[model samples]
Target: MKRYESWGRYPTIRDQKVLTISSRKAPLPLPDDERSVLPYGLGRSYGDSCVNDNNAIIDTSALSNLIAFDPNTGILRAESGVSLATILKVFVPKGWFLPVTPGTKFVTLGGAVANDIHGKNHHRAGTFGRHVSQFGLIRSSGEHLTCSPTSNSDLFRATIGGLGLTGLVTWVEIKLVSIKSPYLDTRTIKFRNLDEFVEVSRENDPVYDYSVSWVDCTTEGDQLGRGLFMAGNFSERRKSRQPKSLSIPFPCQAPSWLLNSYFMRSFNTLYYNKQLSRTVDALTHYEPFFYPLDAILDWNRMYGKRGFFQYQFVVPFDEKGETIKEIFRRITRSKRASFLAVLKTFGDIESPGIMSFPRKGITLALDFPNDGAPTLALMKELDTIVLQAGGSIYPAKDARMSHEAFLASHPRLAEFEPHIDPRFSSSFWRRVRN
Candidate 1:
């Protein structure tokens, strides 16, 4: 079997046919002879779900365009290849925003559906799949189909987290939330240790619509897992100016070792304490609050020439989010510290996409600088802790999980496998098909 690589250090790609599609109305390419087709969005997925071995990969970024939007209901209909960045460019200033968004706005509508991404407000709204109304797709049989809750419900659910296995998502209609302003009223808080942060977070979450924390990965012992917490809601600006276009300003990369042992601690110290020294801030645009790290543009370059791995896994709420603490401590003790460790609460979401990865719990995501084999081994062990906690890793953020571990974590594997076209398969699809 040929191997498919990832954005980080994963290597090998031998059997992939890469095709780019444009924004104009064009018929999808497929022959009765082919087994299946996988739609590739912005190629932002960190790993191989969008990749396959010796098979067709239909790139859809060129086909992006806004189709329609219902101003009254805040519902948006757009082609599958259209990106979130394009939506915000036109809508934020117009008083509407995506209900749930990942860190980057570069993802396409079809990509969001395939990954079913969750945002900081996951505790209140769930994942991106929950906010979607319906999507247009081309199945493996060369037939076009539309899936949604009331229509092809199973196929719809299957496609949400289906990893592009059900078919190629061609377009989507989503419901956006209209806001009073394009600003955020943010509150930043700090915790002395991981234990305290988790405790305080649990207390604060019942009331806030959006909440997330950043941890100090370098500290140990009593201060192990210490971090900063930021919570916010839409700013109540009596009147809001139309939001500005996102400017890259200067395109640059994170300084090498920006998150290394020494540098990371100092950075965390300053950021966490900034909360106390600051006052009620004036109105800030939604761009900074909802996507602070994204401002850097291509910030992933910070990991250096070797690249990095973002390990994000959801640990289900067995007893009110306590397992999360154990996982955090394990990760820090292993010494695989990243720049930040994000922990947040998630609400009950109804996605039966056989591979859907969310539940009532807290998620912890950390990055690993690919120093070498040692780092990879450490992350593999960390995967075990997540599995034991009855959790599943986010495929969009994972590039190194083994198929055995994936199936063990998500027992609902069979539901998605049947839809695959046997003749057309991916390294990622083949790995877990057993």
Candidate 2:
């Protein structure tokens, strides 16, 4: 038995059987005996969704391999274990990039599809699953099913954002977007309040391919919601300035005192004011713009040994700007420090993922250091606010959401249960279901 923890490092798991796969021809059949299992990837999920405690997991990291690529059509097929970092190393030099990518590039292709990850460009390109053409799913029933929009359509939709419950994805084919350079024509816009954020998002969403904002949740009153909005697009140049990849090792977790509210408030002020220019335009490398935190290895250690909770939820785009403000107000009143609060808008493009988190709305993500019961209580309050506003919390980043909240957010949950593979399950599934 081996111990494993997801990216968040909360609710640490132990005594689980791990089956590491290194061969493409490895046979994976559903356990004939009465036991549960799930496919495990890069362990990028922030919560327990990827964890199956006391059960078993098939580690797919070593299955990384590029199966094929078509330069003319920009379609690439690779093993499910292939990381986005590997894809960038091999394809970015050839002027191709992923159609949609999350904040980090260390995630596996299978993980991306399972999470149906949305990015800064979600308003334009949709979730990562939208660009996936097909994949080979190995079921415990000894069936290797080819899933796509036109083939095994139900399974395709279910597997995308399905949380790896449908089956084990062995290989996948994705349609990559063509790029002239690995740089972005970036712009930063400063907004004083939540109202201005809505205005700027509305104005920029039509013109820019990407948009995201850093919100200061600590601020209250007139200065509330003050932050910087960043928008960018691929540069027209044929060559991008290659920046050397550097990593900073985090050998140990920081002390809890280091992540307190006072310190976080100061950091928020500095980050928001760091952008002196209300509007600044520059040709920036994609690395800094898309994956700034990736440069720091094991950055999660900064949260301390107790770990942290990443609360992400989306509210309707209608006249619910005040609802969003109320959420921030609640956070400020709680005096809970959330240093990493991000705000973005989701587009109308619906993903085929039955359990996909993104919808046409305004999404807010905040990271709060886990203070045990108090932290969980704060999340519960946030959940009430989201539910009242007719919104939903993201399951990929969730760990302690109530079963009632899950059903409230995902009305389609009843429909999804029928598609779940009986042989596969996870800690998250058990928590929400039981």
Candidate 3:
């Protein structure tokens, strides 16, 4: 068996067969005797979702190709392997942007569909799957089905947020939204405590297309949730600067203490105090707004040799104070100070996908470099708090979660299992299935 981890390399997976494809001239499929298959992207997922031990694997990065575009409506159709970064390079100049984008643009369209990702505009446009018109899927029966909201809706729904278990996604048809320009008019606000943060979010999160917070969790007393809140709208841009230093430098690593609590707190302070508060600022292109962290490529290396785990969960409006509070209390008490803590409000729930993660409530994401031993245990404890409150964790950001935990997090998982090929499951699916 071979082992596969993540871009972080924190976890190693064991498997039997692995396939890497780079060109359209080269096509590779599983042997008839193969037991299972799993498609991998940029290997960005922080867990075993792309790892299928003793089974078959397909790497899809090189399969990217733009098929067609409807200049009239801005609808785009392309191979599933196309990266959001690629789309940005093409459409941004044409005054188009993704209706829904996660934190990073390095993810594949197929990966976005599998996760049913959402972004700052989620409260307005829903999810990536919501904007996707249709996709081509290969089922266990070896039948390539053209699925959409109208036909094969079941598979369509399940495949969107089903964690890449439904089938092998071949291509996707997506609907793009028009933007004023490639710049962002953003406002940054400061808060003193958790209560203030919630109060401001209740007031502004809905009015803006993008709303997020960078909070400090290590502080105690009234400073518990002191942080920065940002709201953004589309604005005109002048031009963008291109620098080779901005590119991701692979094979580069950081020191082991990069994410230690002391360093994280310092970084948090720097970020929180950067802006004076409630000030209007115009940025150069969407790059700074939608992708501020993108400037420092390989920033993930800041997690050190152990890497980091992103604990992202959404709690319905009804459970924020009661349930979310409990989670925060645990993290603070354990001294696991995250370098980055983001909180955002979700909009409508009727997203275009079946297994989407959005609901009527608030979502929180915490990043922690794996420190070993009780750290994982503490995260599991936090997991129970999320599950018990009727909320679920995000699979895309997950690095470790058990079968029972997966079941608790995604009760809708089994609804689409019948359509999945037994030989096409990942360690993520295996956990939930077992």
Give the candidate number with the greatest TM-score: 2
Q: Write the per-residue lDDT of candidate 1 for residues 37-116, one digit (tens) a residue.
A: 57777767765666765667777867777888999999999998889988988897788899889877878888888888
Q: In candidate 2, which residue pairs get closer than 3 Å at backbone N, Cα or C atoms, i.e. clash? A: 30-140
TM-score of each: 0.89, 0.97, 0.92
Considering summed lDDT, which 10 consecutive residues are worst modelled in model 2? 24-33
Name the 10 consecutive residues with the lowest summed lDDT in model 3.
242-251
**Candidate 2 error regions (>4 Å):** 1-3, 29-33
RMSD (Å) of each candidate, 1 decimal = 3.5, 1.5, 2.8
* Whole-structure CA lDDT of model 1: 0.73
lDDT rank order: 2, 3, 1
Question: Of the candidates shown, which would achieve the greatest lDDT relative to the real structure?
Answer: 2
How far residue 76's Cα lies from its native spot in candidate 3, in Å, is 0.4
Best of the two (1, 2) by TM-score:
2
Model 3 agreement with the true structure over 1-434: per-residue lDDT tens digits: 22345655656556547666564334446756857778887667776676676677777877799999998998999888899999999997787888888878878998899888888887877888878899888766667788998999888888888777777787899988888677777777788877778888888867778878878787777677788888887865545554332655444667776557787667778877787745545553577667777677667777777787878888776634667667777888887767778888788757766577787677898887788877898889988888888888887777687777777776666576676666577766666567
In terms of TM-score, how similar is model 3 to the real structure?
0.92
lDDT on C-alpha atoms for all candidate structures? 0.73, 0.88, 0.76
List ranges where model 1 is wrong by over 4 Å: 1-6, 12-15, 23-25, 30-36, 239-259, 277-282, 318-322, 421-424
Residue 385 in candidate 2, Cα distance off native in Å? 1.1
Clashing pairs in 1: 15-53, 15-54, 16-54, 23-62, 23-63
